[model samples]
Target chain A: MNNTLATIDTPAALIERSRMQRNIARMQQRMNELGVRFRPHVKTSKCIAVAKAQRDGGAQGITVSTLKEAEQFFAEGFTDILYAVGMAPHRLQHAMDLRRRGCALGILTDGVESARAIVEFGRANGEVFDVLIEVDTDGHRSGIRPEEDALLEVAHVLHDGGMRLGGVMTHAGSSYELDTPEALRAMAEQERSGCVRAAQRLRDAGLSCPVVSVGSTPTALMAEALEGVTEVRAGVYVFFDLVMRNIGVCTEDDIALSVLTTVIGHQADKGWAIVDSGWMAMSRDRGTQKQKRDFGYGQVCSVDGTVLDGYVLSGANQEHGILSREGAPDTGIAARFPIGTRLRILPNHACATGAQFPEYQALSEDGSLETWGRFHGW
Target chain B: MNNTLATIDTPAALIERSRMQRNIARMQQRMNELGVRFRPHVKTSKCIAVAKAQRDGGAQGITVSTLKEAEQFFAEGFTDILYAVGMAPHRLQHAMDLRRRGCALGILTDGVESARAIVEFGRANGEVFDVLIEVDTDGHRSGIRPEEDALLEVAHVLHDGGMRLGGVMTHAGSSYELDTPEALRAMAEQERSGCVRAAQRLRDAGLSCPVVSVGSTPTALMAEALEGVTEVRAGVYVFFDLVMRNIGVCTEDDIALSVLTTVIGHQADKGWAIVDSGWMAMSRDRGTQKQKRDFGYGQVCSVDGTVLDGYVLSGANQEHGILSREGAPDTGIAARFPIGTRLRILPNHACATGAQFPEYQALSEDGSLETWGRFHGW
Candidate 1:
C-alpha cells in the first residue's frame, strides 16, 4: 500500500523524488564539467538511500561532518569516507577502529596541536592514518590560512610521524552570503587556489601532497573553473531550500524537500491558519533571515508543491506554525485553508529541517510514497 | 563501565539530575500551594525517566504537545494525558484508538469547524472523548478569544453531540517575553481570569464545564494566585534554559541541561576555540537573540558546569562551534582551552537542544552518568 500525502500523518518530511534526482544530476554534472571528482556530503540527508542515489549519479565516495556519519556510511558499504570537520583528539581511537575494520576513512586537522595529537595517537597504536589539513579560504569557520607557517609545520608533523598526509581541503561556506554570481565565482576560485597553495607549500617543504579539494553549494554551482582542485564536495544541493533559492542558485521548482503539514485550526481574524509542523518539524533555522529575502520560517506551498505567492509561515511555536499572508490579513483564512487541509512548507535550511524528522516520505511522481530512514544525533 | 565526563563522547546532552529534581520540586510545590493539580508538559524532556521524576515530585498527569507524546507516555503507565495542541480532524481515529486502549487522552479544539468534526467523528465512532476548548488570553498565537461567541458555539456542539466537553485551557505564552515579576503576575492573572470566564460563559449557556487550566513557565512561577484555574501546565521548567533565565524565572544555577563538547581546534588570532558542538548539536534556536541578554548560540561553561561569564558560543557551523569572549577577542584562547579541553554549553532553549540528541547523559551528584532515552519527530 502506498502512503500518499492524504494518508500520511501530519508533520512528515516529504522529498520530491524527481526534484532530488534532478538536483543530483545537476551537481554531479557540474563537478564533472569542472573535471573534479564529486564527493557528495551525506550530512544533508544522512540517509543511505539518498547517498546511494548520489553514487548512482556519478558521485564518488562521500564527505561527512562527523565520525558517526562515517561509521553509518561505512556500515552501509561506503568505505571511502572523509570526516570533514577538524579532529577531536578523543575520537582518534574510534577512527582507528573504523580504519582497522576495512574502512578507508580520512581524518582532518587544521592546527599543529591537533596534528601532533593525531600523529601521537597513530604512532602509539601503530596505525598509519590518512590525514587532511583544513585550509581556511574564506575565514568563515575552521582552518589554517594558505600561507600560514603552521600549515607546513602541521604537514611535516604528519608526514614525518609515519601518518599519511593525504591532502588539503577548503570550503568557502561564506558563499551562502553572496547573491551575485561573480562574487560566488571569486569565492570558488579563492577556495580552490588557497587549498592548492597549501598543498603546494607542503610539497615544497619536502612533504607528499596529493589531493586538493574545495566546495560549498553556492560556489560549486557558480564556479567556472576548478583548475587546481582534484575533488569538490557539497551538501544541501540535494534539497535546495529557500535560502538557496534566495541566493539565486535554484528555483522553487528545484526544492526537493518540504514538510507536509495539516492545518489543524485557525485564528481567522488575524489571518492565521495554525499548522502542526512548527520548530519541531521545520527546525529553528532562520538562515534566510538576513538573506536577500527572509522567509520567516518557510515558504507556503500547496500539497502538490505549487508556491502560494503571498503566504508564509510567519510565526511558529513548538508544535504549532502560524501561516499568514505577507501583508494584509486574509480574513477568510479559515475558509481558505480550512480544518484538516494538508499543505507543504519549504524550509529555510534543508540540512537543519531534514534533521528534525526520523524518516522522510519520498514522494514519487506516480503519487506513491516510500519511507526513507534518516539517522540523527552524534 | 560507567561513562563520566571524562569518558563519554563529546557533543552529548548532559542533564544535571539534582537541578532537574529541584526544578520539578519547586514547580510542583507552587502548584500545590495554588490549590491546583499540576500537569507537567513532558514536551520538554520527552524522556520517560524525567517524566517519572516529575510524577514522583507530585505532578498528577502529563500534558503533551503531540499525539505521539500521548502514545509514548500512555504506554509508560501515564493513563491521564492531555493532547494540548489543537486537534486535526484526520487524527480523530488515533485519539479514539488511544482512548479505547484505556488511555484517558484529552484532546483540544478552538473553533466551531474543528469542534463539529470532533463531534461527528465521536458520534460515528461511539467514543466520548474528553474535549477541552482552547481559550485565548493573550494575542500571541493560537486559540479563540475568551469572550468570542465561537467559544460557546463550539462548547455547545461538543456537549450536545454526546462528546464530553471537559473544560477550557489557555497558555499565556507571551509571559516568556516579560522579565519583570509585576508583568508576569498580571499575565498569569489575565490567563487565569480569561480561561475561567470562558468556562463561566459555557456554564451560563447551560453546558457542563468542569476544568479550567492555564500556565506558561514564567506565569506558573510568578502567579500571585491561580484562583479560578483548577490545573496548571508548564514544560521548560523541568530543564531550565537561558531563555527562561532571561525571563527571570530561573537562575543560571537552575538550568539542568547543557551540551558537553570538546575543543577540537582553534584560530588563536581570532580568539576562537572551535568545539565539536555546533547548531546541529545545540539546535538552530536563537531564542535569546532578541532578549535583554543575547547568549549567542549558548553560554560556555567549564566541564564541571561552572558558568564562564564572558565566554559564549559566538558562531556555529554544522559540527563546529566558535567559542569566544562576549565583548573582547581573547588572544590566549589556544592555551586557555586547548585541543581536547572539554566544556559544556548551556543552550538558549533546553527543549530545542535536547531534541537534537537521541539520549541524554543524566549526571548524578556522584559524578556518574546514566543515558536517558528521548523520542524525536512526530
Candidate 2:
C-alpha cells in the first residue's frame, strides 16, 4: 500500500522533506560562513537517512549522545563519529569495540576520575582513543569549567595515558532559554570562547590541543564569528520545533517534523477534539512551557501542514490528545474537527518527539512518501 | 554475559520482579474482593512478559490504548482484549482483521458519527464487533456523558446496525490529581456510577447491556465498591510510579520500574552528579510537577532500590541527568556519587518512562536479570 499521509496509520511521525532540506542547508550555510566544520548530532534523528542528508549537505562528521548511535550510524557506513556524552567507565568497552571496528569514534570526559578510566581502558586495549575534554560554557549540565583544575587534570590524564587528547568541546545548551538575538549571540560567544580558552590552556600546559568544537542550535545560528573553533555541533535544527521557534532561532515555517493524527472523538462543550497522538506519540517534552510562548504540547496544523493558529494540544493522556483553542472554548469543536478528520501537530521538542516513533514518514514535495527507520534505545 | 543489574548497560529500563508481582497481586486481590473481573491495561508496559505476569495473577483480560497493543497482546494469546481508546473510523478495518483471525478484540465509541461508521463497516464486512460506548465520568477527556442522549443514540446505532453492544466503560483520569483518600474514593464512585448509569440507560431502553467497566489507577484502588460494574481496568498500577505515590495510592517503595544509570561525571559546585540516563531514559514526564511534591525528573534511589531521601534528578538533557539534593546542593556530590557508581531513578510516570526503552531489564529476587522486549510505536 502507498504510505501517503492519508494511508499511513494515525499517530505516525511525519517529516516534510522540503523543510528538512531547507533546515539542513540553513545550518550548513551558517557553519560554512563561520568557516568551521559541521558535525550534525545524530542523536536527534538517529535515522541514517537523515544523517546522510546532513552529510550530503556538507556535514563533515557525526556527533552522537550514545554509543548505540555511533554503532548504528557506523554500520550504515558513516564512520567519523563522536560520542558526545561524558564517557561512562562501563561503556568504555563498547566504545573500544566500535573504534576497533574502524569507526574513528571520539569520546568525551569532564571529570578526572572518568578521564582516568578512559585512559586505563584505552591503554589496556592498546588503542589510542580520541578524547575531548568537556568544557562548561553555560553551566547548564555536564562539563568542567574552562578555568577549573579538572580541565588540565583530565587532559594530562588522557595525554599521559597514551590516548589522543583530540581537543575541547562545549555546548551552549543554555541558548535554548534565550529568545532574543542579543542574548543568543552572547551565549554563542561564551560557548566558542570557553572551549577555545580550554584548548589554549592545554596547549599552554605543553599538551597538544587541535580541534576546538562548540555549539547548540541557537548559539550555532546566532554566533557572529568562530575565530578559534575548528568545528561546531548542533541537533534539533534539522527539524525545528516549537521550542526552537519560541527560542527565536527558527521560524514556525521551518519546522519539518510533525505527528500525523486523526480526530477520534470530541468533547463539544469543553471544546476538546480528541486525537490519537498523545504523550505516547508526541512525547512528554514540555520545553516550550517556560518559553515566552507556551505551545502546551504542540502547535496544531492542518493535515497538509497549514498552521491552525491558536489551536493547540492543550492536554494529553497516554494515547489521547485534547486539542483545543487557547483562549475560549470553541464550542463548535466537534463540527470544526469532526471524527476521521486528519491533522498534524508540530512538537515542542523535535529530538524527544522523534524518539517516540520507530520510523518517520518522509513526505517529499512531489507527494511521494518513504518510511525511514530510527534507532530507539541506547 | 550475566545480566544482573550491575552488568547491564547504564540508562536501561529496569523492572523489579518482586515489587511488580506484589503490585499485580494487590490490584488483582482488590478486584476479587470487589467482585469485578480485572483487565489490566497493557499500555503501561506493552510487554508480553508483563501482560503474562498480570494474567498469571488472575487478570481475566487486557485493555489497550492502541491497536498495536491489541495486535501484540492478541498475538501472544490474549483473546479477551479491549481496545479502550475511542475507535477511529480508519481503524475499523484493522479491528475487523483481528476479529477475523479469532481474536475477541473489543472496540470503543462515544459519538454517533463514530458509532455509525463502526456499524457501516461491520455490516459491510459481515462482522459483529463487540462495541463499548465510552461514557465520560469525570469530564477529563473523551466520552459521552452518562445522562447525555448521545450515549443511548450510540448504543442503538451499534446494536441496531448488526454489532454486538458490549455495554459501557469510563475512566476517571482526573483522579490522578487527588492526593486525599476521600477525594479518590469520591472520584471512584463518580466513575463507577457514571458508567453503571450509562449501562442502565441502555438496558432501560430494552437493549442488552452485559458489561459495565470503570477504572484509572487512583480510582481502581480507592473504589470502595462496584455495585453494577463487572470489570475494572487500570494501567500504571501494574508498576506504580511517583505520580501514583503522590496520589496516595502507592508508596515510593511500591514503585517497581526505574531507570538504571551510572554516574559518568559531576558538576561539583552545583552539587550535581551527572548520570548517563537523561530524559531519553527517564522520559520528559514531569507528571509530579503540580503535585504536593514535585520530583524534577524522578526521585533518586540507590542501586539496590533504597530511596535516597531528598536526592532527585533535578535536571536532564538528551543523554545526561543531573542528580542533586532537594534543598541544598550537595557540594560533595562528586565524592558521594563518584564515577561508575550505579543508581536507579524512580520515574514520575511508569507508562511514559517505560515507553522510552525498546526493552526492559527484569530483575528477579535471586539477583537474576532477563531482557523483555516492548512495543514502541502504533
* lDDT, model 1, position B354: 96
Cα lDDT for residue B374, candidate 1? 96
Q: What lDDT tens digits, residue by residue, belong to model 2 across residues B300-357? A: 9999999999999999998899899998789998899899999999999999999999
Q: Model 1, which residues run further than 4 Å from truth? A: none
Fnat per candidate:
0.91, 0.93
Could you give candidate 2's per-residue lDDT for residues A1-378 as a string of tens digits?
687887888899999999999999999999999899999998999999999999999999999988888889999998999899998888889988888889999999898898899888888889799999889988898888999888888888988899999999999888888899999888889998899999999999999988899988999999999999999999899999999999898888999999999999999888889999999999999999899999999999999899999999999988999999999999999999999999999999999999999999999997879999999998
* Interface RMSD, one decimal, each candidate: 0.6, 0.7
Model 2 per-residue lDDT at B341 = 97
Which parts of model 2 are misplaced by more than 4 Å? none
Q: What is the Å distance of residue A234 in model 1 from its true position? A: 0.3
TM-score for each model: 0.99, 0.99
CAPRI grade, predicted model 2: high
Backbone clash count for every predicted candidate, in the order shown: 0, 0
